[model samples]
Structures are given as C-alpha cells and as structure tokens.
Target: MDVSKPPFGDDDAHLRETTVSSQTVYQGHFLQLKRDEIALPDGGRAAREYVIHPGAVMIVAVLPDGRLVMERQYRYPVRQTMIEFPAGKLDAGEGGLACAQRELHEETGYRARRWARAGVMHPVIGYATEVIEIWFADELTLEQRHLDEGEFLDVFAASQDQLEAWMQAGQLTDAKTIVGMMWLQRWRAGHCQFDWQTVD
Candidate 1:
C-alpha cells in the first residue's frame, strides 16, 4: 500500500465532475427523480440520473441490560420484511437529530435520556442522494407509540450476540441496520468513539 497517497486520492484532481444542466424527471411524496448532464474529468460529457432524497436518521437504542431496540417492518420496494433500527425520513425543514428522536419514539415507543451521534452513511451512493445519520440512544423509558396511520411494525429487543449471530446467518440485511451494528460493535470494543449528549 502506498501510504503517501490518500485512501480515496485527491478529489479535485481525480474525482471532480461538473454539472452542466439538471432536470427533474419525477417528483413524488417522498422522493424526486433527477437527470443531469455533467462534464467528466476526461473532457467527456455524460448524463446521470439519480434520486433526490430529503435525508433520514437511524437510531441504535440500547436498553439498560445491553439489548438493542429493533424493528421488523415490511418494505414495499423489496417486498420483504426487514430488520432495522428505528429510523425515519426527515420531515420538511426538520433536523437530523430531531428526526432521530421522533423516529425512536414513534416507531419503538422508547425515549432516551442519553443520545450520541455515531456517524452518517449514504446507503445508495451510486444513484441516490440519501444520507442517513446514525444515532445511539440509551437510558430508555417506555412510552406510548404513535405510529403513522398506515404504518405497521413489530418492535423487539435483541442482545448484541444475538444480532451478531443474525448478521452472520444472513438474517439481518438492511443496509442502515448493518451499519448501525458495525458502529455499535466497534464502539463497544473501544475501536470507535462517540460524542454523547444529554437528552434535550
């Protein structure tokens, strides 16, 4: 490995693309499709199509006994039930942390006394501008869940070991959930650090 070069190399020299024009192909309740003409580094022009997302947040809620709060919900796009952390899209003008807090309560009926932002990940980088902020919640309190009218899910708890086993067995396949699990495992082992915050 050549340590002198940055891991992804210099963005300006090797990774920059200039957008020439953009067009919105479709706009839906939650997503907007866009097509753009861009000038590539090699002086070639190309068209790219992608989705414009409003961003979202995912929470890894930890109970006092070290179990994680999780959810099983049916995803329409994939036509399969998914195991995921409590998450929701950012409402119009909503902040990421606020969305995380609201999602945890609305989806799992649990509120945390302590919160920490783990990190962020772009689940669909190739064609979508969706960024999900990962958060960790602890010191939880049970509360009434207020799910959306047509929303349905089963909220449950699982130990870290159980989650690890599930992941190994290919049972947990949601991208954000897998990223959350990785972050939790690393943080627990002191390989990663989180800036914890008091509940607002």
Candidate 2:
C-alpha cells in the first residue's frame, strides 16, 4: 500500500507525505531503509531520513474465554525469543485487516468471528514509515496453522500473569507488540475511538 498518503479517513494530517528517496539500510531478514525526502507544504525540502517500510499488520486476538493469544519468536537482530502478538507484513495492495486475519491464522491456528480496526501506531517515528495497524480480533476459534517457510517461531496462548512474566523477563520488546498491547488497553478502558478520515 502507498504510505505516500495516509489511509482514507485518516483525520490527522500532521505531516504531509512529500516526494522521497530511499537507501537500503539492511536488505536481509526484514527490509530496512534510510529515506531522505522532501517535506510537503513547507515549500523547502529537507533531508529527513526514515525507514521506508511497507507498514505491517497485527492482531490482539481474544479467545472465547477472554484469554489473549500471543506468540514467542526469536528475533535475530534482538538475539532473543520474545512473546508477541500475531503479526506480519502486508502484501502489496492488501488491506490491513486481511493481513491481520491471515497472520492470526498462520501463527496461532485461529480465526476470528468478529474483527475491528483498533488503531495504528508508527513503531519508530524518528526513522521509519513502519506504521503498524493493531487490530482488535475477537470471537476466535482454532483453525489450521500454516507458517511461512522462513519463519521460525512457536505458538503460545498466554494468561495475564504469563504475559506479564514474559515482559518482566526481557521478552516482548518488539515495538509493535508494545503498541498493540497499549491499544487494547486503551480501548478496553474506554479511552479510544476508531474512525477514518479522508485526506485532501
């Protein structure tokens, strides 16, 4: 999908997407980049570097009994196996909810009965276009799990204590996971509202 403009119904237009140029920072594992680009509406283009990433999708899958389904995976860069929510990158032109449903099935062998867009967060705003959509996935039932060939990970359904332990033990450090958890928290606490606003 095009990060050149925020998704339709994104009311916040704090930053305009100017024309850009990207340089590869790491071409292995996950794609990483450094972008030096123009700043729209400013009339003067400055060299602002960010990771030119095809933003990803994730799920906060809630089980029938209200338990959350998460995962444990070894991240080579971080050199640790962290417990994280099910997530993956978007296929070109793929909708974010589709990616979320697909990933939840692939990683945990579960499909959701109800789906809603929770919110989005830029994982690394200082240097990335990696705006990940953290969805609220509910009414889940077990399905067949089909892992991708290159993915090395484990499937785990965790309780609140278990999740807190993992976080305390230095796992669950992925930026997207943290934001997803917070998104869930805020929504449950009645602190959030999801709406789409078209860009001009």
Candidate 1: give the clashing pairs.
none
Residue 2 in model 2: lDDT: 81
Report the C-alpha lDDT of model 2 over 26-138, residue by residue, as the tens digit: 55445565656666665667776656678898888877776788888888877888778888998789899789878888888988877878778887878777888878877
lDDT for model 1, on a 0 to 1 scale?
0.93
What shift in Å separates residue 13 of candidate 1 from its native position after superposition? 2.9
Question: Which prediction has the highest TM-score against the true structure?
Answer: 1
What number of clashing residue pairs does each candidate have, in the order they appear?
Answer: 0, 5
**TM-score (all chains, Cα) for each model:** 0.94, 0.74
Residue 152 of model 2, lDDT score: 78
Candidate 1: which stretches are off by over 4 Å? Answer: 1-11
Candidate 2 global lDDT: 0.76
Q: lDDT tens digits, residues 84-173, model 1?
A: 889999999998888989999998899998999988999999999999999999999999999999999999999999888999999999
TM-score of 1: 0.94
Candidate 2 lDDT score at position 83: 78
The global C-alpha lDDT for each of the candidates, from Candidate 1 onward, is 0.93, 0.76
